[model samples]
Target: MEPSYILHTKLKELVGVHCNLAAPLHFLGIPFYRFAENTLQEICIKRGLDQKKLLLHLQESQKQTVVPSYQSLSKSSVDVVINHLKSTHMWFIRYRLPFISQMIQDIDSQLFNSPEIAEDMKIIFPEFMEEFIHHIYEEEDTLFEYIRKLYKAKQEGFMNSTELFYLMKRNSIKVYAQQHQDDDDEMAGIRYLTNHYQLPAHASPYMKVIYSELKKFEEELMLHSCIENEILFPKAKALEKAVVLKLTQASKLN
Candidate 1:
């Protein structure tokens, strides 16, 4: 749909034309089902979101043909990258995870003939979900919080001697980046259990939806890891070095 048409189109109509719009709508904090009766412009106004930018995001989300890139975001400020990452986490936690969990619960075990697959779904997937949530918490509380501190230190030029000393002795972004590993293996067990999400020929619709969403979730996880490890981490390391250098020069002057 053209941007002009989409702006005026009711969300339900737009979603009918592009079913994939549902995910991006949810990600943008727009509940399509609740606002199905409203036009995109109305929803934007109600939500106080910039309509043009929201339209651009929706259009980009519809490009199923291309792999979305965060390369440009690497050039963004540390807070900008961190904020985007936090939003991604919110989407995962608030929408995607719950959606998948409910679908998993709704699956008819009898359809799976294989007890092993059922057991894996009941046990392994839930465990993985718990671990994944914990990982997000750890990053937010530890890694991301530390990065914010580094950014502040850089921005303020390490003026506070006590704060500078505290930061210098605290966990450095360089150290964290060196130790950080992309959790590609986090979903490895589940992927192996599901045979890479290959559903049986006789798989029911519910089972199909589960596998499809799971595959998409795994892909999103890989992209999230790439952004953190490749983009955010490198820039953070540079920021840390700059702050430390400023502190050293200040010490020399003192």
Candidate 2:
């Protein structure tokens, strides 16, 4: 859609035609239930978002065919990788998970007459969500924190032998990467439960939206894991090695 047309179109009309816009709009903090009547321009103005950038994101969401490459990011500094990972973590926690949970609840309320699917979702999704959130917390609190310290050590050199020894004793990036399992099994359970997300012949529009969004979420999760395992961990391990090498040289000099 043209930028001018998108700016002028009612969000309801736009989203009706492009249901894929729903998650991106939610990520941009535009709740469709509340702002469907507004034009994109109006929402942008009210939300203080750049209309051009918002339009571009929406358009890209529609047209994007491949997962974005993280090859360049693999060469980026540990701080850059950490920041990108943290932003993805925030998006999952603050936007995607809640939106999916709410959608499940909506489906449950509407599907009480035929509650099997909804009941399965209610039982399964929350368990997956809880584990996912805990994983995020552990990364931020332990793994990311350790990486940051390695970065600091590289930048400042170790303050003392004890500081260096303490960091060396901590779990290394290699260990974390080895222990990290992608969401393949968890998402497989969801896909299996939803019967490969094949919509029933009589599935409602809302049901279709939930299934579509869940599939997208699964893709995003896979990409997130790839970035962490392939890019973040390698860079961090290199950083750790550099810090250790510098400390070793200093000790030899002493």
For lDDT, the strongest prediction is 2
Tens-digit lDDT string for candidate 1 (1-254):
67788889886666655556666776677755557689888877787889889888987876765433586686789888899889889888997887777546545576554656875687777788898899888889988998888788778654486677786687777667665664546889989989999877766444555677789999988888889888898888888888778778878999
Q: Can you write out model 2's per-residue Cα lDDT over 1-254, one digit (the tens) per residue? A: 67898889887676666667777787777756457689989877887889878877887777755533587676678898888889889988998899988767655445433367778888899988999899889879999999888888778765676687676786777778877854335688889888888887766545666788898898888888888877887788888888788878878988
Q: Residue 70 error for model 1, in Å?
A: 1.6
lDDT of 1: 0.76
Task: Tell how far residue 138 is off in model 2, in angstroms.
Answer: 1.0
Model 2 local distance difference test score = 0.78
Worst ten in a row by lDDT for model 2: 106-115
Error of 2 at 211 (Å): 0.8
Candidate 2 residue pairs in backbone clash: none
Local distance difference test values of all predictions, in order: 0.76, 0.78
